[model samples]
Target: MSTTSDPAALSQETEQRPGAKTRVGGLNQHQMQEEDDIETVDYKMVTFSLAGKDYGIDILKIKEIAKFSSFTYVPNAPPFVSGVYNLRGDIISIIDLRVMFNLPAERKPEGSAEDGLILRLDELMIGVVVDSIDKVVGIVSSRIQPPHPIFGDVNIQYISGVVEKDGRLYIILDVDRIFAKGKSTTEEAESLSAVVAPETSAASDNIDELKQQTIPGLDGQSSGKNEEELDLEFIREGLGTFRGFYPDGIADSWLHRRYSEWRAERKKQGLDVQLTGEDDADNFMRTFFSPYSNRFLGEDYVEAVKAVLPEEVSKNISVWNPGCGKGYETYSLATVLRMRYPGHILKIWAGDNDLLSISTAPNLVFGADAVPTLYEPYLVEAKNGYSFSSEIKDAILFEYHDVTHTSTVPDIDIIVARDLMSFLHPKQQASVFNEFSQKTSTGALLIVGQNEHVPESQDWQHVGTSVVNAYRRL
Candidate 1:
């Protein structure tokens, strides 16, 4: 698809000249005045195409129309959220209009000048990827009508008004109504956008700085906490659910203050103020269980994991991958080790406490989205999605084991524990660390979660790749 002129360019073209006739969105000066006279209210809308259908969003909602560029993928985001992109200096979340509207995904051929529109929804900037840019139109209030009952699959509420311009219907979207109910938050939309920036020579040293960033999850964590107000009732209800999994002291302090502010801000925006028990439960599970194995290394932390791997290892390497969610980390390490020691006999003991996940781990299948270049060699075309090669799969011993109480995992050369530390109580974490210290021999590599701050009291030496939190048993 060819991208038509953007709103800015279109406006420049339509500006009246001393001797030139002006045209606004294909209308001559006469038609523009006629449109202005028909209704006291007129709207400037930027129209775009999604799956062959033309739709319009209020021009005021758009920050700018951005060219198609590479974006960073966010795992476990809502289906419509394509990813995030850095625009100029600000990061903006890009939402695919095709996916959001339940239309077919549009893929433009290579080297296209433009492929999406960046919108400023409320306080956040979001990119809405479209098939092509259509012209900017001035719609008269008198000509705008309610959506027909037979409108296409898009949710009717998203359509503010419909108009037949030159026998083609243009669905005018209500910006506030469509996004007001979105799971997207002002903070999360901003944070994801903020992750990627143009690195400069002056800032190269600062690039490796370890910063604690929040992962997008329950209670608007993707979006930062809103602090303008506090809702005590909302706080009380959330704390009730939180107390079941975590200590009351935790709920009383940082967690309490965090949720209270978020709930109040969400309430003020007329967003859902109450989280279902399942919402809280899922966050707890991801925090403790490390269910997102594919995502663990997608951040800047992956370099840290790669940096700590041994250049040359024994012909026989025994590895323990705890919190091995769906076997991604287990298989990932096996793939790397196999490449490093192509002739070695690799024995990986991977386990998780979740029975359902452990059962699924052996299959070694993952969604097509997980097939990044690093993971592609081991992943083969599988029935539903993708699976690992037999060579990569057969080396792992998948089991159900709770690491918190496990005492014996002997002769381990390396232990990869990602996202496991942050979930445990401080006492439990200390206990697990102590157990790890006793079970592994000297010089054993122990890798912890990226954001986790392991106790300094433990007698362990920090290995390189500080972002990934790797250590050597001293």
Candidate 2:
């Protein structure tokens, strides 16, 4: 009539029972119970090693596993704090578990990356560095034994439990308790949340305050030129920090115009004009992209692009399309080019930094209704859905490439890089522009984002209409 939570006690009970091994359907009671336990694997842990000992965290808490180095060092942070890393675009603080637990760690060579697990703790994302990452281990929840002081080098409070599987003993870590703010025994432990989450918030607030301040001139009114310039500078910095959008010579004119609009809109809403966070920065620059960015180009957009096409061109038209995400924009452009010059041999070198997107782009398929009418001529019905014709598919070479690197694409007649320059560093933007100038001859067309503008130079002429921001090398 009595029940126990201990697995050892239950096993002992099974041993004491009479006919415990009596077979039913060629399997004993204990053997069947073992199979049932195996089938009920509800808990999954991403197992890893720290200082030669196996440790695990709940799989649900893991966002991803990554290996990267050169984290941007924070000015004042705890010794356990590795630094901040830009995961794609969102910045996350990195913590070294070995350092936090006061354990010996393998010293990686300078600039060498360490294994890391990005954890999604509530709304905050943090990266934890470890010695090595192992495979995922799934076991029954009831098999986990209570944490003991002698089980792991980590504090008992941080250790959730210990589980043994295949001769490997894993120390389960309660990340919630480890990262919980104001609930730790020591001041250093309590500051983990403060260092990771609140510090970023405070930095964002400081940026907002710096942008909101208006310096007064001799006449008592705010200094229009200096204040506006200061606000613009902050906006540029925020765009780069929050979203990696660098508005330098490439998007300077559009940035100025957008700043005026953002200021007026914020004033009308009685809110500060400064970008507060990622969401605020996104809202400020929402109208900066072209009409159809990630999707197929619309009918009007195709016509507008076609209108800007040069009247006379060579028989072999070579085009370079960077940031060709999922090949939607590339396919759209290819369709337009094919229609614009049917007799010309079209070749498009499409490049994107996203490997998944670039790999799947060549095999992109869509329903007939999903694409614009302009793409109807190139549609070929397949088992799954309609895909581009062989001619259109063969015309493009989708490669995983970053535009900041040296491009092997031959001399280009046209470059379609919309909404790409603003996301790169200023120096990178300058380098890409220089490449464009170098690879292109006179009358080569250059199409950028709607809000972006090519810098004024004798080598390039502004030939864009109100619909498209384009230029021509002169």
Candidate 3:
């Protein structure tokens, strides 16, 4: 999917010429000339139908397409939400695009459907329902044009492009934008207002007391220090408050993005502020660290990891697996390498800030079903559940290391930090990015989160499809 723009871009493109007559005809002379000017590229698209209209999404973005299943409804959720469901013990929210776009409601609320496209975006998994999947067709880039004005009924900004094939138009929908906007439907505003109305007074009183207790220099009334210094202190106190509220998975990037606007409002009013309200914190936390990514051992993602591997497997290689939650990814990588290149020496140094999580890495035990089917050969039945082979255990050296600070990690070849950088602020992200480049060998592979793109200006060159964020060190 491409980067998204606001509604103005849609309006500007849809502006009709003075004598322009909207018709379903072939391309014009100007469009044909433009097509000839550029090299024609083909993108493999998984075409699906909704409300009897055809739409397509990039096949690479898809993790696994499954049949429709029953979901548990969430009360007070947005109108477009179908509800949540437990997919193999992982709870995922389902979104009904039919209702989301005000199309004719054709899908049944409960029952199996033809297909559900499962998308893993930023550690969150969402299943989108469609009537039936057409064929995986190749659409040429030159044939793709800007969104047509007829799509104004649905939100136009979400349409990335339109392609004409076999005298029919296929609208390319940007999944990222659809999920971002659909999560906050119009009904959500009313729901949020009602929930906040009763708590406003009590929250005000608590904020007043908290400011007096937490904000430094507020009681002293000192004037010698600069305002910028005081503002910095205020931010520090705010972050501390947030830490107290959330003990695990707290990222400064998420904190600022979630509350920066509110902080600006407080500063404009010339009033000292405490931390953000409980509601905002709850919402942001839920969005960032969703429960759906429990195993982090999906087959499709593991295959993508395998595809980027260098042709010549080194006899001895070092790898750094940062943010190795529950060591799921750590074990998966070990299994892949062991099977792919037998007798190859592997030295993986996996670490996570979460102490309890990193501590369990040495045990090499996993739930009976936690391990993927392909890696089952490496598992031995244990009293608890299953334990990986000793060979698998010997390949890793798990440690407790925080990437935020200047800490020495083992000289490595590959670094797998998926969905880890998204939690960090831009400053921290850059710090980590530079550190990864310095720590890795020349031409080492960097497999980041699906949507995490390494800038071209940096010392990394993007390899393979732009849809996949795999990079090779320069």
Best by lDDT: 2
**Candidate numbers sorted by TM-score from highest down:** 2, 1, 3
Query: For residues 1-474, could you state the per-residue lDDT of candidate 2 as single tens digits?
Result: 012224477667757654655535445766778878667666788999987899999887888889969999998898889999999999999999987875668889999989999988889899999999998888888989998756535767789999998899999999988887654446654554455355445545654664465333323565677777778878988999999998766677778888999999999999987899999999988988888888999998888999899998866788999999899999999999999999898999999998988888999988888897878878999889999999999999999999989898876889998999888886566557777876676778999998888765666788898888789877
Checking candidate 3 for backbone clashes, the offending pairs are none
Model 3 misplaced stretches (Cα beyond 4 Å): 1-282, 285-296, 425-427, 464-468
- Model 1 clashing residue pairs (backbone): 91-193, 187-223, 188-222, 188-223
Q: Global CA lDDT of candidate 3, please?
A: 0.66
Q: What is the Cα-based lDDT of residue 406 in candidate 2?
A: 89
lDDT of 3 by residue, 115-209 (tens): 67777776779987777778776767667789864674355667989987877778998877677645565555556456545344444565467
lDDT at 346, model 1: 91
Report lDDT (CA) for all predictions: 0.65, 0.83, 0.66
Count of backbone collisions in candidate 3: 0
